[model samples]
Target chain A: MSSPLAKPQIIAHIQKSLNYTVFDSKWIPCSAKFVCLGNFARGTGVMQIYEVQHGEAQLVKEVEKPKPIKCGTYGATSLQQRHIATGDFDGNLNIWNLESPEVAVYSAKAHKEIINCIDGVGGLGIGDGAPEIATGSRDGTVKIWDPRQRDTPVANMEPIEGETKRDCWTVAFGHAFNDQDRCVCAGYDNGDIKLFDLRNMSLRWETNIKNGVCCVEFDRKDINMNKLVATSLEGKFHVFDLRTQHSTKGFASVSEKAHKSTIWQVKHLPQNRDIFMTAGGAGNLHLWKYEYPAQRSKKDSDGVDVGVAGTVNLLQNVTLSTQPIASLDWSPDKQGLCVCSSFDQCVRVLIVTKLNVV
Target chain B: MTAEEFVSLQNQGAVIDYNGKVPVEHLDYGYIEKCKDVKYLEKILKVLRSGEEGIYPDLISFCETRLELLDPKNRLLITDKPVTTAASLSKDEWGQIVDDLKMWQEESKKTEDSLKHQPLLNDIIKENIPPIRGSNQSVDIQQKQNKNHCKRPLPRDYQEWDKFDVEKECEQIDSNSSTTSDTPAIVNTGLSKLRTTLDASFLAEREQLNLATREKDKGNEAFRAKDYEEAIAYYSRSISILPTIIAHNNRAQAEIKLKHWNNAMKDCQRVLKMEPGNIKALLRRATVYTNTGRFETAAEDLRTVLKQEPQNPAALKLLSETELKLQDEGMIKKKRKGKKILIEEVDGDDGHNEKRQGGLKGEIFWVLYIINHLSHNLYNT
Candidate 1:
């Protein structure tokens, strides 16, 4: 086998120094464009848009807002008409059109504390053509928003107050529906993965994984296989099965000493659902592959052995920087390309490949 | 390319031909303004620009000094760039430009003050500190290596791997499985458990939604029974489950009965933002504004209502009350000409510090008193 222990290839480095720390980044679904948010020099919150043309990243737009931007995600009609949605420290959420370069069409105060993560939740047939948005906040709440209505949230799932209000760190929606069923999962500071079913306003499942859950993702295209992968602060990966009414099954140690800090974000490739990448606070990103157990019985009531239902092997580990990675977002269409933001006040696009052929 | 080469190109481009392509907001204007700490900020800024292009992690340090000079209450208004004159802008456009800038500056300050309250900024600062690499030859070499590290492009496909070995490993796993080692029963248990838990969550969501609807229906029933307070409470509860303009509007009607003008005003404002053309919200806001003595704002809201419904007697009444208030005030048109005083001398008095400290205590006392007064005012309002 080609040695999977290879370093990711760096394509372009964006050298612009943000006056404030960058909180998150998102790739515009189909294009080589990306948007990021941070504090501007004036201490006011600001967002910048960048486009990767040929090989270089050129700054396309910079908009000044009122609060420090904590997280940003891109949404589109079908990966062509791009829109950027940003969550700020003051609970203000703004969704902007990349083409207009003017006022944000959708704006509202969504949370009390900083919005830790903002994800575009697709596959919800909510009548309104506008995409629904999901946001995780330090206030220990996950909210669902529709762009058409700005002031009030469509739905809010707050953690039981008496229990530890673990600040939600990240959120991802599983478009990979099993039998036309989709779900959304949010990772919390206390390492809890709570899946929410949008079709019905209900909590799907909650698990207490020892470490703080930093990132969680479900396979995008593979619908029948209800699989979930969660990365935690303790450098451990937990894969859960939503089909089976039993114990959760998969655990993969991709980078034991690869990152000196907690893993910040993880993303499954849109094109290849089996391949996934995780960004660590130690400025390292590790990729892994899950090989299904061959001896496993045929699809049971617990459903088929999904991609993450068995053993996982580390493929490549690349050192990004010393700065803790704040967030990592993969293009829903692109195969290997990804965008990562960090405390280093930089966002870089990296390419990974096999180091050597066996 | 090396870090040095990258820096030279960036600096050369910045110095010679300004790439207006990089928005003024995105430019590392901090480096330009705070040139005193050139080495540190420059290095950090370089790494950020070359790596991410737009996101900056160390912007807090740059804003620390500026943030100190501003007032917390008025921070949003004060942080505006003291307007500038451009040759491209005509003399007639000056007044509008200055007004626009001032408006945005105030807006920006409000945004900044809100940002200061976020928890993540504090976390980011605590977590992401750039490894302080001092000015050394080795450091320069490392910087070059770091630049190259992030500049590599990602692979497109399975870099068509040497599948021969992977196939062999797969064959090994396949043949070994035939020997029949015990399958981890834990896996099956965990999977089933997950499935059950997921189903429970879906059911719980439906139950919650149903409860919300029930609460909302109860509120409507109370409203129909003419029990305004009970209706308000039920509506509030329903809004907690799912906030809608109708609920807020219903609550506003109850507030009107209770004569809670300010609360009604707030509800009306919220509904207006959600549904701009809401006639009830507009009418209620006009009444609240008039009652609160904000005549101009009251008149504006009433005008909007009247425009939509020309025969709106309620809107006309509110407009008349606002106009009456405006007639009494007669606009304070005398503009205070502030002195352009310049303090060129630096104070050498240590005694000045003592005086300042004394004033600081008094100011603190005043601020505390003001906050308490404001809280009372808010409560009463």
Candidate 2:
């Protein structure tokens, strides 16, 4: 792997023991620092700043709150600000400045229950749109926040009156090709995945994957809708080609059972969107690369254009932990460098060698 | 054919070079002046790892020194001698070791104030340490070298601290501050109310018990998978939250698998302390005693188990083995020492073998169900 002739190697580089249940980990953009969000045994939410220097993760800052944090994202804020927006068990959304995390820079009562997942886009110059954060919560609502407009979310997708509320598990933003062309995709516990167009304020696409959806991610958030991958409570994960949507069929998809247990997460490489990784409940990480189908769009029986599903090739697989790996984040500054947190209360820094060659 | 298709390479000004993409934050000329955020500066330090010896030489180093003088921990000093940077951090780094070293230094300083004697100063003075290594070496080679022996901070007065009762200390601190405060009465009332509000934790005592049981179940899962270390950790967590006899017994059984004789004995003793008549605990403790060459204690535990249940084959088999061991030591009279125990004479003596292939990784644990006879070979998941 070092010489690039061998297969990509997933090496567990460094591991730091944490005293809390880390629900999420994310790399700070253009930097070596990464943030860990989790709750202590006594249920106090903790945000820790770990700067990776010389293959070591240094805990530079730490802050505690009354509520346990479940999810966090750096997508909504620019590198200069480098603010971390988090969702806690109390269903409150907070953006914090790492320097002084005693109080949130921005806070809002996002939901009635816990916010399970969150994503941010239009920041750091990746996408051409207003910087925004999307949060999916146990309250069965997916909301989008523009930090400039504090107190309330700019957009909220919720269950209709009299309809049963399905807990929202994950959410992501994509299709930000221009200033006003962004979209948010949300996954629910009822196996339903919904993509809401922010510009139109309507559902662009929705599908059910037979099990509670655990995660939904777009390969690239800055471009027009290209591809999306959704993992579920079961071992199944589906990749949808979003470039074309038929009149009847939403988007062509290819499903694969990658893990023996729940598929916890899927992270697309920041530099190469074609390459991605899936973390399994059995503590295994499966690196995959998506091969575009020979044709992206084809005519259906009634002559309507339908999308073609791509084939996902398993590039590499490594079991670096024993417990379920809860979360993993790829670093933006360097390729193949990533951080993963497991149920065992340890955060391991892993380097996937030979990713660029693949 | 190759020459016919050749074309001159031209630089396309229209294309945005993704490789050279600079962050939007760096575009601002007044960023350094406006950027008061410490995290952002940390990132910049990462990008330019050697700001200490930059193009402008002392410009970056001057500011960094002032920053470190501002905060000692931020300086990331490798030893007593102050180093400006973690040495061009472009190699295999260890964050936890550095943090632990800093903590040890603080601890040493506190001790230094209490006692004017310094113990480790000689070692520190003798050891010629390089704060940073060259970044040219490949990571793999550096990691191998690090494994052999690497730089770690050793304070002048380092000693192992005694075990602390974290929960007791926390409670003591809480009570001490509240009693001294003007609103001591309100603080007492506030805790009970807060319990009802924070449903993120167990609602009541019953719920906490249930949570502990759930953790025990998780420990059982790890044990069934033959992950003894993780099982011990989970069982320890369960005990810290709420101790249960079953959790203790299961922990002992798991400890026995890992040959943690002392820990297994301790867990068994804890269980026996709570329930003297606990058949499972007695049998597990006997197993530990036999393994640790305590035949007398093992025979006693086995005798107690046989007294409780005459038809218990596992205990009977273990007792027979212990009796032979004792007889060999000339300590106890063994009536069945010479008799070869036939498997047909004892029912369920085959040692309850269960192959659990349920859920993602099934068959956690049951106190009454699977016992520790499978000590020879724990079924691999």
Q: CA shift at B17, candidate 2, in angstroms?
A: 57
Model 2, span A1-358: residue lDDT tens: 3352366667676789999999999987656668999999997999998876656788989998999999999997754466899999999999998877888999999889999999998665455556788888887888877777767777778876677889989999987645567788888888998888777676766788989998889987864566799999988899988867764577889988768789999999876677889998988888888877666677777666777787887767777667888999998655677899999999988777677677
Per-residue lDDT of model 2, residues B1-381, tens digit only: 354323211212232233453344432334434334454444444334444323443434543543355443342221121111234232444354345434533543343243223232323322321121111111110111222242354543333334556798799879866664332111101111111111213123433454466456546654643556656765776786788899899999999999999999999999989998799999999999999889989988888888989999999999999888877766322223211122223334443232112211222333223555454247543
lDDT of 1 by residue, A1-358 (tens): 4331233332323344555677777765434567787887676887777876544567888877777887776541222235678888888788877667568778888888889888764322111123567788998888777665547776677755475577988887663322224456888877677776554556645666878888877754223233578888876676654434322343322223234468777777654555677777777776766544443334446553422246565655566567888777765433455678778777776443332221
lDDT of 2 at B121: 33
Chain B TM, cand. 1: 0.31
Model 2 residue B139 CA deviation in Å = 51
After TM-score superposition, what is the CA distance of residue B187 in candidate 1 from its true location, in Å? Answer: 13
Clashing pairs in 2: A54-B92, A54-B93, A55-B92, A55-B93, A56-B93, A56-B94, A56-B95, B120-B156
By summed lDDT, the worst window of 10 consecutive residues in model 1 chain B runs over B135-144
lDDT of 1: 0.58
Q: Residues B1-381, candidate 1, lDDT per residue (tens digit)?
A: 999867855764564322233334434554434333333333444445465555654663443333333322221212212112233345555455345434533543443344334333323322322221111111010111221233344554665554447778689879766654334332322111111101112222333344345445545544543445656675676577667788788889778877789889889989989999798898888777776777788788888888899999888877887898777755431111111111112234346555455555555666799999999999998
TM-score of chain B of each: 0.31, 0.35
List the per-model TM-score of the A chain: 0.83, 0.98
Query: How accurately is candidate 2 docked according to DockQ?
Result: 0.01
